[model samples]
Target: MTSNSPDRPATAHPGTPVRGRAHPPRHRQGPSPEEGELLRPLTRRQIADRMGELGELYTRTTPSGRRKPPSGRPFSSDPSALLAPSPQARSAAFLRRLAEHMRRPGFELLVAEATRPSGATVLTACAYGFPVLGDDTWWQELDGHLPANLPDLAAPGGLFVIGDILVERRVRTQDQSRDWNLARRLQKRLLSDHTAAVGVTLVDRGDTDTVAALLSWGWRCLPSADRRLLVLR
Candidate 1:
């Protein structure tokens, strides 16, 4: 949704190297270890238990790859700053929204995990959403007229709202670029149960990068007066 940005985190390019961490040596001998495997959908309780870790993932994968320092302090130079958890207030607010959304009927949450060669499982990506009810309530939020064909997609069996999709950052090389595709898979898994339903989400009007990425992924933009309304059939 526009309030949350796009499904995928609008972060640094996954292929960019972070200043503090050393890139793991790649083993071209077999499949890459960073490739994520979809996990079973999570329940609200499971999400509660892992909220801290999820918050870190959200912070680390943000546009700057680090949290903003409080108003009076200078940015930290500590190497660990690159992997620091999100600021408490911001993280709490984000988790609150996730929890609130989970309360909606038909809500579904999916997370993808990848294993390091060292055998540690890491959160790779996440996506969650619910079916939109067959009513005019949701459409009334927009300022302009809806596209003619769009309403058909929102009929009884046709619309699913993709609340958010988040992906973690990883150092990458040409041969181990698989981590970048995790967002797509998370979304695909999110929609797997809703056969023939069109997926819809919103993005901030100024978020050109996200809009470009969605367009590249085959989602088309529907005309809207303010925020962008994107749909995937």
Candidate 2:
């Protein structure tokens, strides 16, 4: 999955986080009272309700002048399910099903929410992660060849691949400060609460903003021509 730039990294290094093994699965328990008000976890239904916004968010990320995948979206199975459409119906549906098992190790999905002064609920952030072998890359085991020698996957962390942080287009321009603040809050809670050892992302050459953001969160980049793997403790 070639990552979208930061304007850019409102997501990753939530690396698509995991609740500490010390804590029970979130499905069985809730965050303690002290976690923070801004970082609240929502159920699958909660996220499904906002799938429309997610679809729009997918539209927003497309670089200007470039088409938004032939399906008018990315993440389409036609290309590859891992490269699924951003806000397509099927993508959201798949996400809904995945959300049920979100609290488990190996795979984790999160949809963080926050309320606005207007008493409206908003979808502030989302992230996805999964397990991978040492030689894994965005291309996976394509043709059974790695682009370069890569290190093993980190223990305790899932591969954070999708971190979507966006607000409504109408509010995005008028409330840039609020948007960033909310996104940052979501990212912080995600990183602090969960542990995604490494993030497997797809990107062109050079350490882009996505790489920098992961590094800031105690994640290191294992560079390869084939993909960008962000590792953590």
Candidate 3:
């Protein structure tokens, strides 16, 4: 995708070195009605179709050789890896500009996380008034903290706005299988619930193959758009 600014260079190109900590690209302008028309409305059946499409894309685009490091590595184990400090600073700056575009009142922000958050990322989300939804693991820990029954994926009001997509891949311990059916289930539920408007930030162990395998299940890999919403500075 082309950067809106003529002066800025494109971030993704063939043979670019992979940064251990890459800042998400800037957000493209919100999808126009024409583009929105292209996306099927969120429905359980449609969600399944999208998931299949994503899975096929992931499998086809990612090769098996590009596997991520083992879970014991620093980046793989640390939740903070989801947010690089330098990228966070840039993201904060971007948020300021984004706020200008969100002039309508009563917009509520939600930050979805697949695992426990780092102190820094938590602080940042709080600073921005974004409600945190710690999926699966976090939900289990804090489920008691929320209401007895959280509503299904329906946006509470038309006011729901996702600030970022956080992808967290769970490592297989000795007892845990490498299978990712649970992750795929959660991903589909969220996507179907939110429609395709929510921006997703994929946080994995930098395993392109494994990540691709997960993405193949139904996740969209629009890094550029994610960068715009999640990365601010």
Candidate whose lDDT is highest: 1
lDDT of 1 by residue, 168-230 (tens): 433211332243456566666677777647888887665565676666556789878767899
TM-score for each candidate, following the candidate numbering: 0.67, 0.44, 0.23
Which lDDT value does model 3 have at 22?
49
User: How much lDDT does each candidate structure score?
Assistant: 0.67, 0.44, 0.32
lDDT of 3 by residue, 108-154 (tens): 22222222235231100110112223242312332243322231221
- What is the full ranking by TM-score, best candidate first? 1, 2, 3
Which TM-score value belongs to model 2? 0.44
Q: Rank by lDDT, descending?
A: 1, 2, 3
Off by over 4 Å in 3: 1-37, 49-52, 62-64, 68-136, 139-202, 207-233
lDDT of 2 by residue, 1-233 (tens): 53333232344365565333243323543333212335556555665576666555545532222123433455455545444334455445544545543544444445545567798865545554445445444345233343353333332334444334333333223332342343344444454455554444444333244454444434556655444555444
Worst 10 residues of 2 by lDDT: 61-70
- Model 2 misplacement above 4 A: 1-37, 61-63, 67-106, 112-114, 131-185, 197-200, 204-221
